[model samples]
Target: AGSPTEATALVCLDLPSSQVEVVARSSSVAVEPEYLSIPEPIVFPTGGGKEVAYAFFYPPKNRDFVAPAGEKPPLLVKSHGGPTGATAAVLNLGIQYWTSRGIAVLDVNYRGSSGYGRAYREALKGRWGLVDVEDCIAGAQFLAAQGKVDGERLLIRGGSAGGYTTLAALTFHTVFKAGASYYGVSDLEALAQETHKFESHYLDSLIGPYPERRDLYRERSPIHHLEGLNCPVIFFQGLEDAIVPPNQAERMVAALQAKGIPVAYVPFAGEQHGFRQAANLKRALEAELYFYAQILGFPLAELIEPVPIANWPPPR
Candidate 1:
């Protein structure tokens, strides 16, 4: 129930003796305790002052390194997979991967995310692309405005439903400088019509009854609004993904390539909707970091195989 940096304890209250007994007070993790980044809960305004969203900000931390004087760290804004799922202050090594490497992380719990109450969850109904994207953008902007992160280096990433939000934000807004999508939905219409029955029914509330409100789907779809997305992006997809097939990432990558935008696509064989194998997970994370380093013109501390980017080093 506690984060990696914090410990959870179980205690007993003895009525007869009027004394407290401590049963448990510690937890363990693979990494050393001092190396883990701590999460700070943050609430910020979004929707042009119409609404508020929550997030957990983890600043860059390393036991042996210090950042350059007066240099702000780059930020990676994470949108959790389930549009319905909420992010907690849990010890996530995936998040620590960035923080441990001199990058700040903002794990956003946007408007539609659960655990905030009925009205908050209902906020996404009929407004999936709008409210969620707005909240994410706002969270990044809030941190930038507070002199916490480099606004020019704001990046976003997500998987599945969260990946949809990443694409929407990049396509419809100009806040982020780069992004990475893992099996994201580029076209909402395609997803509504092609996905399984459960997801199809779910979209009824998320984007409106499919056939009847088809116009909304097209308007919100990132594939249809590619012109707005001018920055670099990298995509990771499982070749055998069924929920969000590989075609989703392929189509977007192709479009970006044609537009001369910086893009990279890394597809894994035998992987599915979410990466389960240990090796694939590690490779995906390393590839994403490599992509960011190349785009941002920084040298990575570790040697990682470079991801080939289409339309890189645009003509000066």
Candidate 2:
């Protein structure tokens, strides 16, 4: 069942009262193993002298293509959604999509992220933007120090809560040169005032009681700190997103454009918090890849039609 290329298995566990049989499998599709980079676990130091965990995936092996000599591949630091959610070491085509095209990915499981026990998950309490942002930055620095990725060409991206971290990193730090926010939160205060019932009180734990500590919210919200954001960014939003709403992305796009930063925005009419439709998903992935290639000055292996970017300088 366990093979080098792919594996499938069925096992039975005998309990005191009954036997349970489960089927586990990997896709049989003929995706070349060389086109996929195995996930490597990493632990690095972050703020407050604490450490965080992440999984790093290097550029894939492609016989037909090679990067320019002496050029380290650009790194894309991915922040998984949920701030509570964690990135898994699964065979994800989405991660593979970037790796196969010569990009390195660091899937961060930042502090306050789940799966590291209740205490770590609670580490984000009253420090949503700070802990997550510092952990992500630390992961990128660790990789760069190891000479595994190009330090100058670092990019950060995420959706939902992860999107919030992406925006925070780009706004508050100078480490990332570019970013992509997929339906990310730009205004924590706005979110607290307008989010759905389920998350209406969620920030009370993530930040503090609303209105009581609203100043902290304003300080952490990326929209309010736009003066510090100078890098290129592309955003993808679902018009029907109720949790974060369209305005989250719209306002950020507007602000970046006003500052003459390179920016692009894509909105899907019928989508929600996360993209569901296959077509929209495909479009989002291709657009992000194209956006990064344009900003990082790299050639994409695929022939994706260019997505227009505002303030993008003409090719020299």
Per lDDT, the best of the predicted structures is 1
Question: 1-316 in candidate 1: lDDT tens per residue?
Answer: 3555655557688899989777876554457766789999999998888889999999998898889999999999999977888989977888999999999999999998999999999999999999999999999999999999999999999999999999999999888989999989888888887888766678889989979999999999998887888889999999988788888788888889999999999999999889889998999999999999988877799989778999987879
Q: What would the TM-scores of all predictions be? A: 0.92, 0.90
* Model 2 lDDT per residue over 22-42, tens place: 576555556777676778888
Tell me the whole-model lDDT of each prediction, alpha carbons only: 0.90, 0.86
RMSD for all candidates, in order, please. 3.1, 3.2
**Which pairs of residues clash in candidate 2, taking residues 3 or more apart in a chain or in different chains?**
none
Off by over 4 Å in 2: 1-30, 48-50, 314-316
Model 1 / residue 301 / CA error / Å: 0.9
Report lDDT (Cα) of residue 16, candidate 2: 89
Report lDDT (Cα) of residue 109, candidate 2. 90
Query: Which pairs of residues have clashing backbones in candidate 1?
Result: none
